[model samples]
Target: MTTPDAPRHSRPISFAIFLAIAGAVGWWAAFNLTVSKIEVLENPSVDLACDFSVLVQCGTNLTAWQGAVFGFPNPLLGMGGFVAPIAVGVGLLAGARFARWFWIAFNVGIVGAFAFVIWLISQSLYSLGTLCPWCMVVWVATIPLFWVVTTRNLVEGVLGSSLVGFGAALRSWVVPITIVSYAVVVLLAQLQLNALARL
Candidate 1:
């Protein structure tokens, strides 16, 4: 058990920094892809399809109506959503002592972004039948970011002593169990999709 006075694990801040960097990179790549798509629309010679090979094609997923979820290039959303958190993480890493309430609010936003990423992944897998490589990067970065942020809050006693105890209990059981279960579900869903694609 961690002593009450012990410094919390530094992994959360570190992971947050790593994720922010990754997110920034992902956003940049997505933005470039979006620009490329616009160029393709302007010129017929450019094939927008992401399928450079049997396994990859941006146009296959991106040219579809779903790609413009809001009827515009979706990367703009990523650009705006990702940059602020990265800035916040960088500031925090630089020794900014954000108030507990600020951290809590940050966590809430992370949760929302995580959920949206998952939804987008599902849409790509099932509806688009192709994946944007940059989008996958965002999805991967989000998982660790969410986990680290939540774990940090728990370890740092940001949620209060009682909630910290509850979080510790949940971490020992619920967290791992939920992660494994979700992994299994995702794997099974992918297998099913692959099977259907073969048929």
Candidate 2:
């Protein structure tokens, strides 16, 4: 019989699949914006952000060397790398149970993508001196998606609940703490960046 204290199992694979889909959409938008900029640059046209000046200018940000950090269009990387995991995620969500190793591997990929998003934001703020609005959209979308995917993995025991401890330590403290901590950190970082901009 299932005990009252039995852990509630969620579909981590399904959450991962959803994140992958959202990431793919973000990547597509970014790619289209990049391509549009290229066309405009090659033959000059009404500026993309004519109404907005400075940091909000898409044309200014897109034309920067840092925008093509790979020495080619950066969106290509997003298109190729970001979409594959979503496809894998969809397979898993379809009830194709993955091995523990596969789940862990995908989790690592999500962490890597999270790190890369932070790096890109830093580049835009400090190095590029301009922001790609679509890229910011990707950043915002990625944060919650990562949190949900990671939380689902933890709750479902795919990452070993013991790694975060067990019992009340797992359910009550760790999960809530993680969620709140992430939200706080993201908020602080955004505020700090905005503060710096004013100085």
Candidate 3:
């Protein structure tokens, strides 16, 4: 996985740009959520801009126990966690080559983020019964980010040499795969929450 001999141009410029853009979007969503949380704290009954309706609002999710799974606002995690991808993307754009260990660790973080997003989706659709607008933006950013990074890592042999061929095969289908992933979420929301009518 170590690519000490790999040429500088081995880095994918498009992937770097995508990573930076996704990270920026996710960070923006997190920042908004953090501000909303602060406003709620300062005035418990304050209404947030993200609150659209009973079925489409951030108030419920923000106040729920799930929002603070780690005893703090969940958006705080995003505020800090998203910086990694931004830095990595900018580094790659600046001709910085990451070591194998770095890629492995970064991939692990992305996997964790994807998993957390899955959990939040479940909570939003089944338990919370509402769609947080800003949170959905975060989800949109994360879903594709996870897919692209994981696929790129596999294609680059960051995960393992044995999976390189499979990764290469999957790389070209990443966009479609991501679209299907989003479709599944939308379908679930429609089926369970009748989200389409509510919106």
Best by lDDT: 3
Cα RMSD to the true fold for all candidates: 5.5, 5.8, 3.2
lDDT of 3 by residue, 1-199 (tens): 7599975466678989999999999999999999999999999898889998999998899999999999999999999998888999999898898899999999999999999999999999999999999899999999998889988899989989999999999989999999999999999999999989989
For model 1, name the residue pairs that clash: 48-59, 49-59, 50-57, 50-58, 50-59, 51-56, 51-57
Candidate 3 residues lying further than 4 Å off, grouped into runs, are 1-10
Local accuracy of candidate 1 as per-residue lDDT tens digits, 1-199? 8899988644347655775686677677667667767766897467654445433456655667766778886767777777766877687676566788987887897788778777777777777666566666666656656766776678678877667876666655545754674575457446646632532
Please identify model 2 stretches exceeding 4 Å from their true place: 1-17, 44-46, 49-51, 164-199
Better of 1 and 2 by TM-score: 1
Candidate 3 has an lDDT of 0.92
Model 2's alpha-carbon lDDT is 0.64
TM-score, cand. 1: 0.72
> Clash number for every model?
7, 0, 0
